[model samples]
Target: MPKFAANLSLMYNEYEFLDRFAAAARDGFTAVEFLFPYGFIAGEIKARLRDSELTQVLFNCPPGDWAAGERGIASLPGREEEFKRSIERALGYAQVLGNTRLHVMAGLLQYGQDRGRHLEVYLHNLAYAAQQAAAHGVTVLIEPINTRDMPGYLLNTQEEAHAICREVGAPNLKVQFDLYHCQIVEGDVAMTMRRDIAGIGHMQIAGVPERNEPDTGELHYPYLFGLMDELGYDGWVGCEYRPKAGTSEGLGWFRKVMSNKY
Candidate 1:
């Protein structure tokens, strides 16, 4: 069976942020990841992880001014300086938390922006991020978020993500294959995985259409997981999904498919 990491930011919404570490550990998840850990100090987050004996497999780089509706600044023009600073800051957290991968979100395109110029900035930023992450023994990931949940998102398909990874030509740069996004943007999840699993660094799962638990999704995760097993994928799969009930109560399918992720 594949290793799984609970997405504290999404799954344990009922608990306080600090409490979610223990909550996830109590629920039998030894590995966990989240959207961002910028609000808390590195020592504080590291201490929580140590106390719970949890391994944080992944987290995203700081997306500038999340409150002001800026999802990320990596691809935005005139934001390269901020993105570089965020990369350094993220590397510090990863070193402290023992996180191996960090996702660099490509900010959405605004009205009147040039697509060609945007891609240039994005690839440039990604190449830089990948270099920095590699120095810290961390791999940088780029995810293709679906247009439905996040319209105008710069990268929104697995094929495009795979191609970008190739274009960047960085050994440390890889794709974050989010099944929920892939199912919506592209239907052939299993086939996509088979084609470019080598370029994939991390994975996430959520239900289709509603973004709920995987059990209700149209995609047969069992079959996809079987394919992953066949391909010898040993990476931690982030459980980035909303619960229909209490987080623990809605973990029936997760627990059933889980194995010794140690």
Candidate 2:
């Protein structure tokens, strides 16, 4: 089975932000990821991870004005400087945390007419982020979020993500394939995942539609986990789902998957 990491931002919410690291550790999760860590300094987060002996697998670049509803600034035209700064700040944090993977969120698309401009900006910003991250031996990731969940999210398909990665042509640039979002937007999750596995840097999973525990969903996560093992996926598979019950209670799925081959 693939290595599993709890999403501290979405999982174990009962604990405070800084406390989630230890909570995940107590639940037998050796790796963890979150959206952003701006609230706490890198040194503080590093201490938490060190104390828990948990690996910080992945985290995202800062999204612009998160409190003001900005998902990202990457795809927003005329924000080149802001996007580059985000990448720099992310690298600094990743270095302190000893984490190499960073997800770069594509900004929201305002209207159909402005999409072309946004794509141009997105590609340019992605290329720069990839270049800078590569210098530090860090990999930059981009994910395709489902429009249903994030209506205006700029990136929405594997094809688009793959194409952008190609155009960027940076060895460090790769896709952050989130199974929940992919299943929501495109149903050929199995084939798409396998076909794009090489270019996929990191992967996340959650139950479809409800985005809850993987044990009860339209997807047969067992099959997917088996497929990942068959494919020799050595990267971390992040558990980025909401707990329909308590966080630890829903982890029966992970236990079941790890105990069996499928």
Candidate 3:
């Protein structure tokens, strides 16, 4: 079976942000990931993770203000300093929590920004960050968010993410292939996984359209999971979905789907 990790940021609606660690453990997840844990103190989160015995599989480097529509600035021009700062901050937190992977948000492309130039800058920054992460045994993942869900996003396709990874040519830098986003933008899940599995460092899931529990959505997760098994993927599949009802109620569906495999 694929190791499972709950995306506490999106999964739990029944508890406050800080309490989701316990909830994830209660739901039978041995590991968890979150968007950005910048608001809370790192020590506190790490302490809770220790208490809950939940490993930190992944967490995102802080993207700029979501309310301000700043999807991210990591790949944009004139934001190198800010992006580096974000990486350093993220590394600090990752160290505290014993995290092994960090998702580097590729910010939205600015108007009139030269794509080639931006890609160069992104490569340079990623190379530097990858070296830094290598020292600590943490890998960096670049996620390509679907433009349909996140308009104007810079990295929206697996091709683009793969190209960037190739250019960077670092062992520690890879792509975060979220199945939900990929399903929305491109429906060839199994084929894509087989093609890009080597470059992919992590994964996530949700039901398309509704972004709810896996079984509730149109995508056939069992088939996809089977494909993953055939491919011998050893990483965690993050359950990063919204709760249709309360978090606990939504969890029942997740449990049912997982039980079918047994």
Question: How close is every model to the real structure, measured as TM-score?
Answer: 0.97, 0.97, 0.95
Worst 10 residues of 2 by lDDT: 253-262
lDDT of 2 by residue, 1-262 (tens): 6899999999999999999999999888899999998788999999999999999999999999888889999989778898888888999999999999999989788766588888898988988898888889999999999999888999999999999999989999999999999999999999998899999999999998899998778998888988998888999999999999799888888877767744
lDDT of 3: 0.86
Off by over 4 Å in 1: 259-262
Candidate 3 residue lDDT tens string, 1-262: 6788998888886789889999888888899998889999999999889999999999988787878888776777788898888888999999999989999887777678788887877788888889888988999999988878888788888988999889888999999999999988888888999999999999998988789888777888878888888998999889888888877777765676568742
Of 1 and 3, the candidate ahead on TM-score is: 1
Off by over 4 Å in 3: 257-262
Show model 2 residue runs off by greater than 4 Å. Answer: none
Q: After aligning candidate 1 to the native by TM-score, how far in Å is the CA of 174 from where it should be?
A: 0.1
**lDDT over C-alpha atoms for residue 165 of model 1:** 87
TM-score of 2: 0.97
How accurate locally, in lDDT, is each candidate?
A: 0.91, 0.91, 0.86
What is the Å distance of residue 29 in model 2 from its true position? 0.7
Model 3 root-mean-square deviation: 1.4
TM-score of 3: 0.95
